[model samples]
Target: MPLNNIPADRSYTDEHEWIMISPGQTSVPTSPVRVGITSVAAAALGELVFLDLPEVGSEIEAGRTCGEVESTKTVSDLYPPVSGEVTSLNQAAIDDPSLVTQDPYGSGWLFEVQPTQLGTLLTAQEYAEKNGA
Candidate 1:
């Protein structure tokens, strides 16, 4: 993938998760951040088979395992980019876990979190640079 194609607006983790501040009813300074597996991660995981998601309103801590994602090759923990309450989870992805590999940065989002602390994450450029993009 082209390094330039990495969405400039979001932050990424080495674990292959992408997180962006969701544009809430307000300006989203303190609103939830949408969480999802990155295309790189999705591609590496192969076809997704199942997604174990957390319930809405679940208090999750930053950098902790909030759920699990089972793929054709392996089962990986879904980590939160930031610590906060889970506002919502994508039922569509739950029903069709393959959506995670289909559109990793879009409708395949895992959950929305109202962050209490932004964990150690990297910007798109930073991630690209770190990964030799």
Candidate 2:
């Protein structure tokens, strides 16, 4: 699937996750970043039916499986693009999984974390090229 709408402001992972460091937060190590699966992943997963996200205050490792997303096609593990404590979850998306595919970058965001460190990440252009999107 063509991902023509990858946002330029955030960094992407090879696993198809995206992380957006909070705006106005210059220090990434302490900033709370928003995390979610990319449109490419959402499309590949087909229609989502269930979402299990990490609880707030839970410590998560970058690139590690933190939760799961179940779709009609398959059940996929959800990975955080950066490591830290989960600050919050998007309850709206949890309640309505379609929001994840409908608006992956907006209301579909999965969770937020105060990052302790970052993992390998690519710019939007790099991600597009890597995925052939």
Candidate 3:
């Protein structure tokens, strides 16, 4: 799964988060972005133990802890790639954390956002290159 990563095309954060911008989607292009953790993050966490998602309509700041994950007996905070309002959380992921280990980019996605800023993230290729993947 790591070899064929379906990386977010938009940008990422140094904290290992990914953001996908959806333009012409009936909302402000930069406001409501989709956010998730990088595959690197999932791999580091090993088998997921638990997940906590933000309530819908909550405002989140970039680099701030919005949620958390418990894996391998350790808890890690989930960071936002960009500032935004959470529009939706991945209910499926909340139900099953193991999916994060199986498909970090697909079924493991954490939440969707209405980004307040999209310029503050790194590109998918850039993030992979930075992490030496």
Candidate 4:
């Protein structure tokens, strides 16, 4: 199956989450990072139907189960790419989960976090190679 194009600007988790350190932000700890699932993940999930995202101001740890994603195919845990306090959530995606698969990078973003630290992340090339995308 063909996967969606992977953007080169962000870091990705093996579990298929993508994290973009906000523009003009030089460091992970200084600014909020946008979090979302990679297009490959969205495709694999198969027509997302539901989402459970962390609340604003809630502390989230990288690589931990912060929320959940439910698709027609199966349900999967949502893992943060960095540890921090959740700054905001994408209410649009929560209201209509298909945005995740329909526009994985833009309006489909899941949340933003003011990160304290980051977890293991792979470069876009590395992620693509690892997943054979």
> lDDT: which candidate is best?
4
Question: Which ranges in model 4 have alpha carbons more than 4 Å from their true place?
Answer: 1-4, 22-26
Candidate 1 residues 28-113, lDDT tens each? Answer: 34777789988778887999999998899999876789899999899999888778899989999999999988998889999998
Worst 10 residues of 2 by lDDT: 21-30
Task: For each candidate in turn, give its C-alpha RMSD to the true structure in angstroms.
Answer: 3.6, 3.2, 3.7, 3.3
Q: Write the per-residue lDDT of candidate 3 for residues 1-133, one digit (tens) a residue.
A: 2323735455667787766653212233644556677778888888897988788999888777888988986898988866668898888888988987787767777889886654456656667788876
* Alpha-carbon shift of residue 1 in model 3 (angstroms): 13
* Clash pairs (backbone) in predicted model 4: none
lDDT tens string, model 4, 1-133?
1133878778888999999853233466677879999988898889999999999999999899999999988999999988999999999999999999999989999999999987888877778898888
Ranked by TM-score, top first: 4, 2, 1, 3
lDDT of 2 by residue, 1-133 (tens): 2247888878888999988853233455656778999999999998999999999999999888999999999999987878899999999999999999999988999999999877778888788899877
Give the Cα-based TM-score of candidate 4 against the true structure: 0.91
Among all windows of 10 consecutive residues in model 3, the one with the lowest summed lDDT is 22-31
* Cα error of candidate 1 at position 53, Å: 1.3
Between candidates 1 and 4, the TM-score winner: 4
Better TM-score candidate (1, 3): 1
Give model 3's TM-score versus the native structure.
0.83
